[model samples]
Target chain A: MSPKGKTRIRRFSPVQRLFHVLLMLSFLTQGATGLSRMYIETSWGKGLASVFGGYESCLTIHKYVGIFMICWFLIHGLYLFFKIDWRQFPRSLFGPDSLLPRFEDLGQAIQHVAWMLGIDRLLRLDRWGFLKKLDDFLLRITRLPPLNRVSYLKEFDGLLSVITKPPRFDRWGYWEKFDYWAVFWGIPLLGVTGLIMAFPLFSTRFIPGWGLNVVFWVHRIESILAMCHVFIIHFFIAHLRRHSFPMDRAMFEGSVDLAAARHEKPAWIARLEQTGKLESQLVAEATPGLRALFYIFGYAAIAVGAFLLIGGLVNSPSITW
Target chain B: MKEAVTRVRLVYIGGAVGLLIGLAVILTVPVRLARGQEEVTSKIYRYRERVATGYYEGYEVSPRRARAILETPGIKRGLFPYGSSSAMVRIRARLPDSHKGLKFYYRNTCIECHPEQARNIHSVRAGITCRQCHGPEPIPAINHYYSAMNTIRRHSYVCAKCHEGATAAFASFYVHEPPAASLETRESFPALFYTYWGMLLLLVGTLAFFIPHSVMVGLRELSEHLSFSVPHTLMVGLRDVFKKLVFFMSHSFLAGFRKFSQKLSFFKPQNFLAGYRKLFKKKEAFKNETDNAP
Candidate 1:
């Protein structure tokens, strides 16, 4: 069969797919319940609290769901460690296969922003009005590093570029790497501080001064960052991207449609075919039932998440009590 | 590439705008104002003057209330033992005074709104016992925090709310002169007004703006790229620090048993020599027994 045909390309395996599904459910639950607890004074919060059987039970749900998510991550990490050969582990910082990020990505990001701001127009130089030219000049001046480019991240152009780019991934893009690793950063920060808040009296007994109080704020602040980053930013990128609108079922079905695989991970696909490992990389298509399940859950989550964020923002979610 | 970047640029523009808006809001808006902050410095000065002049003399304890308060055990045997700061303040207010003594007493959060007053009170009263300074009279008042009748804090009735029972638990401590006495004479405390505003800006700036993006991202980048990690290092260090703290706190009584425990060393030369000598004697005895048997 020609590789151009609609051959299913295995993306996430069964374990990985299960992990993703479980993670989605648990994370969504945790985010919802946690926010409700914080903003318990709001009407939605009051409704949610009652729906979850009041404040204490809502708290219980958030805690256990968080623990479950952590466990799922640990399982996924351990599986990857044991299942992959140590030599084949993704280690390079920047390459065709690596997510370590490359200078090219930095350049792509800068180019992308320039195009967005219409600075990259070919014929705009002579047509430039005074203010437009001033704007261009200002942008250029602000773009310069404070010092003679002694640092890769100086003026954080690299970081800004990285932040701006959606994970229009081939192999793994910058944002994909961030998505993969951010949990590693967020989990401990969230978990320990969360646990501290979870068992405040016990923690206060052992920890001194305003330690538990600090933990309380840290937990709230970090959780808000994590939750917002996931619900708003990651949602837009992963599910609502131009190419993957409505939803991305790549994670749920454990495979991407052949064209998607070719578009996004073209190099991976080509390498697999060249090495005669394409068959090994192929997987059965998601059944109608599974597809239905994916959509049902995915769209439901999207709706709930959207509702929570939009309503919370507009209403200024708060707890009076 | 241009199209891809244009799309990317849209995303960037959106995020940047969001960040800027959050920053602007955080910087421009103050998160909180002191409870009763007003532009009436003269009112505060007038109130302080009334406090200094000693508005009314209601220290005389009646036999009836003294008996009642004495039986309560928690109430101290002193002036106003049977009543709270609110009651005494109300009494002072009702007293015939040319000043607004009653209005000041019933007024909500004069000191509460004054960050300068709050800060001064905190510093001056840090290690001092509240009872020693305010005298162990009425056990302050059980202040209801929410929905005050007139003020933000029910405890705004008097200084005794914080100071009265603060030192009751401690047996040996000297009370510094009340902060108002020394602090009222100085004019520099109002400089703390700016400090309060600065704090509001900082809190909003960090939590609402800076921490939301810059600090969070900086921390993330630092953790991933840089070898230094806040969580990794803080957790391990905290655990060790806790263990050491617990050990010392638990062993405080055992200090008498080993007066120089901190200086005592298990790696002493005498101890090592004793063990070495014992081993040497046992080896010699074993060798002689083996030779005899052969």
Candidate 2:
């Protein structure tokens, strides 16, 4: 059959999707091998380690995969460099497209919380001059000096404005920014520490002997923390959210339903409309085979991640104690 | 075509870089293997006692308890005596009657049995006794059986026993025995010490924020999607308390309070009562209708 009509908006490019897959696979492998060594004394840990031939084999796999990931991380950095428009410069860095945190994100976070609790509805007023009323009330109460004809009260007004309407998502949400930065920070820290452990002789030459101990401790703790965040938080936001229950196939298929995208990322949609690029961004719907593959892969990943997470937690000192 | 060319260029560049790195890593194979062998050879005999101590500490069992476990029939006979080849041959030759006791007493001077250790650096330079350095009691014969399996590297806490001032001043973390070199003044390895604190802060700060944020967001999403409602009484009480607090803040209490209440219609007690009653009234009405019909 011919491809379906254009009802999907492109989200992730092919390269990004590829990176996501590789990263996911490597991360899972690392979690499995790393956690196995961590909880080696426990019977389940021993069992898991045995699957990879033993503790020694687990360490070897963890090391080699880690090295591969480090290389991949560098490649990713290079990919990003080549992708950026140097002519755009600061706009490419500081614009909405970038994942960097901004002042508005704080307000958005509060607005999100308010939205979640139904307080947004309570705060919203449909009458004219609501902004004026809010400004007057704030000025009367705080008695603070105005800020550039639009004080922090304007922020309150913005909050009310944002809350009154449906919460508009940009290209990246706060959660997505967090997830991106976590990996960005985590990869270098983990890679360096892991390399130190991998080549002790070289590392010890530069670092004091006890620095190795500290490195090992940080590596383990950070890994556990990462596992907890990804399996619980990342999984929830990406696939388990109410709107995206079962799975979000955007990353898998490189596009999202136009209607869903419009609802979820109104700001992005509006920008696209303004630029008249929405039509070009639209793609034919994913084939059934592709959808099936994604579902199978997504569910499998979730299962593996959950298993590793639970296994690690169960054998952790806190729970075991 | 331009995008394709850029992609091709990226692929070539990435491939060339990857090949170089791969080759570099491959070149290190021999060196790493040689280094590995050297490490094993060096550590095997010199720090056998410390390694054995680490192995014992891994069990987290008391010496008395370990003795009891080892004393069980068929187990003690199966246990090996020493970790190192030198220790096995020499210890067996020197301490023929030593295996008689199950209790490990550190009082035994290790140098007497293994006098070769007297020439060791700590002994000759520092005038440190084998008993003081390696504990007064060596590990008992029963526990020595598992010393061969002491693969986990352990830093010696034995150093801290004598270096009390350094331990007290610099060795704050009790995760393992502080490495002897680490117990210097802050000026020594200041960077590593600071990095250690920074790592700790990062770990704590990330977990502290992310875990709670995740949990709260998860719960909120779940609750909102699942349509979980707060208890009616609790909700009402909270609304009342909040209104009262706001009333105290208002310049004119009665008028402001009236306006505020008027503005937020949901704050009206009648609305709350009506909703609360509606929720229960259906169940009550159904029960009454059934009862009356019967």
Candidate 3:
């Protein structure tokens, strides 16, 4: 079939899809239940508690959700080890293809924001543009080493030479590297602290009262950061960024429209064109059933959250040590 | 790609090995520590028994009663034997309404043994004995029966008398310190006030703001990206809804009040004034533009 006329909708591998689904569920449960516990005196807390049967029940759900989230984190790390190209990972850090902030990126950010507010005309930038650059920076700073190291560049280069002939590498195509490390470190901080709070046995055994208090502080702060980042930053980039607004299916379909690939990720587009597998037309179609399900779940979550807030405020139960 | 694969495999193996070792240590360490704790606890129990018996012998009360007295609640086994005895005596006093107010004879026997403690027992008259309260005759059957019941009855009240007043037993035992105020007292009000404020802050942060904010943000994002297939979109949407609901519930009263106030005509005037000012300014700008155009 000719690439210009064909519709290509390649689905994500089952494992990847499963991981994404599980991650979304776990994060939602954790954020909701955790907020409820923290604000036990609020009406929302009470309502949430009522829906979950009681305060203890909501807490139990939150605890298990945290565990599941950590499990997903570990699984993701393992998957990265098996699937990712480590040689390409390190080289993408410092090269122009890297997501590391460039002098122009700062100016681009200002311009983008101005455009969003209708102050300036939009500028056509690279695939992972200014906003993505910021996201990459934040993810990099947040992550620990091994996943975010330039030290591996030499080894990666040596390996690359042995495997295949050299080709021009994108200076900024470091999504896999950034995403892998973000998951790696983010999970441990969230998971370890969450486990400590959920199961006092571990906290009591290894940590004293002061240590537990420190964990509480860190966990609470980290949760705030995670929620804010996911809600504002991740949401803006994944769905609200320029033409990608409304929805983007690259994560699920593992393919982009040739136009989107050409504009946003020219390197990937060129590769696709060379391979003669580029999808020409992009259709923005959402199944009715899927859309309905989204609305149902969305409204349901809001209703439950409101209930917890009310319950927490009205019946502020005394916490006995 | 091959090197990437190798590195990836190494991480997997390392992670698996680390997890296995951690799991093994977590599982085995607790059991070993518990066994050690069991041995230590047994030794401590034996030592406590010996100390308790020696302390009980020092008191003038019957050895049997002394052993039984500490078993009651609120009486620490070794620290206060006389207080324990007094508790037993008070319970015996309260039992029978028919018996003309029972007299507790603390002076004669207690004073003879411990002169210092005798000086503090002002409630007791100069001359009294165990028989004074127990009816002065050694009826073996009644004595034995009353002895068992007295330990149970006097346990709380006798402890209270010395532990209650300006010069309570507990006060005297320490350096005559005043008892701390109860939760309802003026002294406790500050703590309660702070607790209330702390709870208020927590409520505002978690329920009123954070949960709702999370849900709203999540839902708004989910709405924008509605193309993701079933379960994925549904899951994110559900989470968003939950957070919003929690936020609303947390701040219902505040929300209701805000809405009520916003609806009033008095509050509406400010908005009207602002709008009129903007309209007037726009008219003046238009006039300037027309004048300049000519």
Candidate 4:
């Protein structure tokens, strides 16, 4: 229950974590440079362009960053595929070992809903008693005008229950699979469009003028989507949700202990217990120095992303150097 | 285990084969371009040329892609790159009387054959048009007129024509200069197609994977009580649909189809993938042990 007795287990390797840091930086750089060019009329865009030494320099930066993004994405992918054990490959997808969705995830999802609704506790109540009366009273109160003001809290809490609740990740649940595959899937799109946009002259030579226009829209929309997704959705899931707000430098600190693992990834912990690998996988608590670094890097990135998102939406005119 | 290996190989090979087939198709079958030349003018969707009619300030619009300065409302035309949208403040001030004009709306009514129809103002030259600035300059007889990049003496005069026109002067609306048209006509087609479709497929795949979970998560009211269930989300949805299908199959007037259902079930990957054997066999073994219990 306390921090002292908590056990630690490794998630991402050093190489993987390093790649992630590089990825985050490259993506952020690419996004900043690209957006500046996209909305040069706006302050943020103009500021970025100026900071990077004008539009041409920004373009040069964007092109190089894009290439770095593509190269690293490839290296990460190849690293993954290089170690794919043919025998265990099947499990690597839908099995307990992989991030891919599987049938077991379905069971986990339903169970999570039960946990979310506190239905296990609810089920212990009698049908036509005080609990039902309480339920009826609450439901009726929801219809009243005065009480309706606070009734939104009920619905909001229901939604937050899903977000705030610790996920019991059995191996790789659908949500984790989603996050993993988001990078897996997004790399190609970000890479391909970034490449084309980088070499517009080379690309336009073969494609129709209007076709380039199409790529232009796709690239623009996709970039915005990626930015918004990372800023809002991914950030919320990874860091800002109730249990893990301000920072969740699990990536930086490098592991989750047995106590944290039991709550967050119960199925994984259970499997570890079943397989008798619990004590072996235990990592020591993180150093205060590393924790400080996580705060510096993690919170800094989150703050930067949030600022960019807000500034872009508001069309801030003075958002630059 | 074998299934995973087969599936991985299938995916890699399938991807390669798909790419090769797509390339072959694009190469062998020439691009059937609309060229925006064929007569698309109609009575319902009238194609009125805005500049030619000289109602430049009003509703007199045109359908010509090559020479069209502005387009008429309710018309299905290839050109109309100027997204037809303007800021509300700017509109309420300058185009107040002309603001009620319907031509600003996009008509995806004929978008399938005419995909360029899907493009709105935001897409074209930062959502403004040549006519909006230069005032209905004639489309040059040659596409090469605008083909040369950096060849033309740069001027803010064209920009001032619109941005500084009788309306308000925008803070800034600078855009990147277009690349040389020679390069555009040659290299752009494949590059555009690849990036556009590639991202589109990735988006679609993400959605396909995401939606089932979202939908299942949405059914929390039911799942909360039904703690032990077969599956959640897509699998459950599919099961419900399959149940209905089976029910209909058995009840329908055609009796032969009922017998075919069991035979057809064997072809389904889900039969094994669901790990039903784990559920049933475990249950049976549990039952046998319980029967042996005193």
Query: How do the residues A1-321 of candidate 1 rate in per-residue lDDT, one tens digit apiece?
Result: 744433677776687677777777777788778777765656777676787888779989988887877777677768866765457433322235544445456655454344334443323343555434544565577775435333533344454444454334356644566676667777877788777667543443344213433344456656666666676667766564333545678888777666666655566777777879887777666677988998888889888888777766655624321
Output the lDDT of residue A270, model 4.
90
Give the poorly placed runs of model 3, Cα more than 4 Å off: A1-13, A86-184, A238-242, A249-257, A274-321, B1-294
Model 3 over residues A1-321: C-alpha lDDT tens digits? 434433333434568767865766677677677765665445555565576666678878887777778777877769867765577764443334333433434344343233333322112222337434644665677774555444444464454333332122232333333343445556798788778756543343333222334455456655655555455444444554433444555554443444444444455546646766544433343456765665455445445444434443345453210
- Please write out the lDDT profile of model 3 over residues B6-85, one tens digit for every residue: 55456656877999999998887645321101111122223343212222222222112111011233333344445656
Question: Taking candidate 3, what TM-score does its chain B reach relative to the real chain B?
Answer: 0.21
Of the pair 2 and 4, which is ahead by lDDT? 2
What are the per-residue Cα lDDT tens digits for candidate 1 across B154-236?
A: 22333335433211111011112112123331332222223333434543543463223323332222222223222235445
Error of 3 at A31 (Å): 1.2
Candidate 4 residue lDDT tens string, B1-294: 467556666776687799999999889976634332222333443356432321223222222233211323333345443355634322222231322334633442333433543244333315564334323322221112231111121122243343333111111112322221223423423443455556666556655644444443433323233323332266566545655675676578466766776678756766765568778888999999999999
True contacts kept of each: 0.00, 0.11, 0.00, 0.07
Q: Which ten residues in a row are the worst by lDDT in model 4 chain B? A: B147-156
State residue B77's C-alpha deviation in candidate 2, in Å: 44
Residue-level error in angstroms, candidate 1, position B247: 71
User: What docking grade applies to model 1?
Assistant: incorrect
Q: Candidate 2: where are CA atoms >4 Å away?
A: A1-4, A124-166, A318-321, B1-204, B211-294
DockQ of each: 0.01, 0.07, 0.03, 0.05
Model 1 / residue A278 / CA error / Å: 3.3
Instruction: lDDT for model 3, please.
Output: 0.46
Ranked by TM-score, the better of candidates 3 and 4 is 4
Q: Write the per-residue lDDT of candidate 2 for residues A1-321, one digit (tens) a residue.
A: 113598888989999999999999999999999877766667878888898889879999999999999999999999989988799764455567877676556667777766665655545452456656766776787775667438665566676666655457888888788888899988998999899878754554444444555676668667866887789878877775544656788889999777776666788989988888887888997788988999999999999999998887777763221
Candidate 4 falls in which docking quality class?
Answer: incorrect
Note the chain A TM-score of all models in turn.
Answer: 0.75, 0.85, 0.61, 0.80
Count steric clashes of candidate 1: 7
